[model samples]
Target: MSDVRTKYKDIIEFYKTKNIAVLMGGLSSEREVSIRSGENVYNALVNLGFKVTKMDVDANIARKLIKDNIDVAVIMLHGKYGEDGVIQGVLELLGIPYTGCDVLTSAIGMNKIITKELLKAKGIPVADYVVLDPSNPDKSFNDILSLGLPVVLKPVDEGSSVGVEIIKEEDQLKGKLRNYLRRHPNSFAEKAIIGTEITIGVIGDQKNITILPIMELRPKKEFYDYEAKYTKGMTDFVIPAEISKEQEEKVIEYTKIAFKTLNCRGVVRFDAIISKDDGLPYFLEVNTIPGMTETSDIPAMAKAAGMSFEEVVLKLLEYVKW
Candidate 1:
């Protein structure tokens, strides 16, 4: 197996003289998860003999970045300000190179509805969905029913499945949706594709992309929610998902199309479900800044590809751009 430092020796040497900051712990719902992800990356970079610092992001992040003299930023923040274009825009103004997608890509990828729309237009097979309107709860409820019962509701702009829920019965639909809407006004309901839950990790820039082995996620809970995602043993991960070769090829093709359509760069994760009904993979959503924690799918996928956690960290840093 090739090592990250050995493969990108020049990039590693160049960053040796620079101050790298692992930005995490922002004011997002996924702040705790982000902090964990940041700590792992921070330790990985340190173990790899790189000059790295751990920084908790807040409203004064811009000033903090300047104070620390951060030459490069490895974004470990997951939701809201971190995953959205806000943090990326600030980095742009400060002229600091950062990992992951650019401002526009981050913005689009953060919003599930917009991301779906863009991918759908590019001929990607996304599950049928309807945007929830807070003002008209009844209308939103009706629209959700249109997608049929047993639908999945998710916040339009959240990661780690912060406010995701599944409505199984008609009796529990309206109440669940109303309460969910109250918390996350900007949400959407999508037809649930029952099958093997799978996700694929993609790395590299637009010119050259590498798709990691597809992993099947079997969450012990109702779905891959926050608890299932962060808690150890809450989910079982299967690499090279138990799917036919043809199905795997189609998923890879769709993933590439979605990756290029969103202009995604650095390390990103595309999640989907291979329908048991039709044996077809339905691309769910794109996670631009995938978690780097011990239990994260990205690390697991990288491990299956013969890359260590430290190597994955350095690999992402290699794609840093201003």
Candidate 2:
């Protein structure tokens, strides 16, 4: 941690005079959510006395970025082109530094199937799952049997809980899969872990990393869908989650390992399912470009860890190296 601070101090001081671009609102299903996060981050950076630009990202983003001479980019974009490493690749080509994971990690982190495979290979506990393409939805059904009923069908590369379904019975499987395919056109199914869902926030690069407090997400309905995730009062967040000390320590430890295994940088949040029976935590997925809204889980976790939202945002900015 001390080494992380020392190695990144030059970048941090350079940020004092840099023109930061807050990228958000790409042409994705999660545009609205990205806009919200972008607004929050833009406002915070402005309050922190940085020269900031709010860019509604699109195909012309590269042109705009080069034209504006963006010293660093604060990526507040979610889903599709934003979180899938497209923008990061663009930044790389344009010779600009940005926050969050690099191209490889960002692309892998957003794809649930890929992320699951990576975690499984690392001996990390993850729920059973199968990938489904538009040409072969029936194959997914076959894979679902092992995972049992009441499984979760979700878009492979989407966030903000878009195109996610919680199928409670085998009878409803076909219809749900058909409907989801009609909308998403490409999706996957995962065995829904019926346990407490928690998110752990981690910061820094490969050389050094720090784990923030754990946040327990309690949804009102069957699962933490889009509505429950974003809608006010639809969910409850318990920071420094009310888990045993051992469980908390294990969660923090696993969170760090997962972040390092993914080769993630900047700030990321890992979602996990803690089984009530044995207290074992299963790694669900990692969000490399997590939401930056004030009410977002990462921010909540940082706050619980004695860091304000502004400080967390600034801390992330400090790590942006070109």
Candidate No. with top TM-score: 1
Q: Which candidate is the best by lDDT?
A: 1
Model 2 misses residue 252 by how many Å? 2.0
Model 1 deviation from the true structure expressed as Cα RMSD, one decimal place: 1.3
TM-scores of all predicted structures = 0.97, 0.93
- Model 1 lDDT per residue over 146-215, tens place: 8898898888998998888888887798567777889999889999999989999999888989999999
Model 1 misplaced regions, further than 4 Å: 1-4
> What is the per-residue lDDT of model 2 for residues 75-148, given as tens digits with 9 covering 90 to 100?
99998899989999999998889999999999999988888888778777887777776667777677776678
RMSD in Å for all candidates: 1.3, 3.2
Q: Residue 295 error for model 1, in Å?
A: 0.7
Q: List the residue pairs that clash in candidate 2.
A: none
lDDT, residue 322, candidate 1: 48
Where does model 2 exceed 4 Å of error?
1-13
Give model 1's TM-score versus the native structure. 0.97
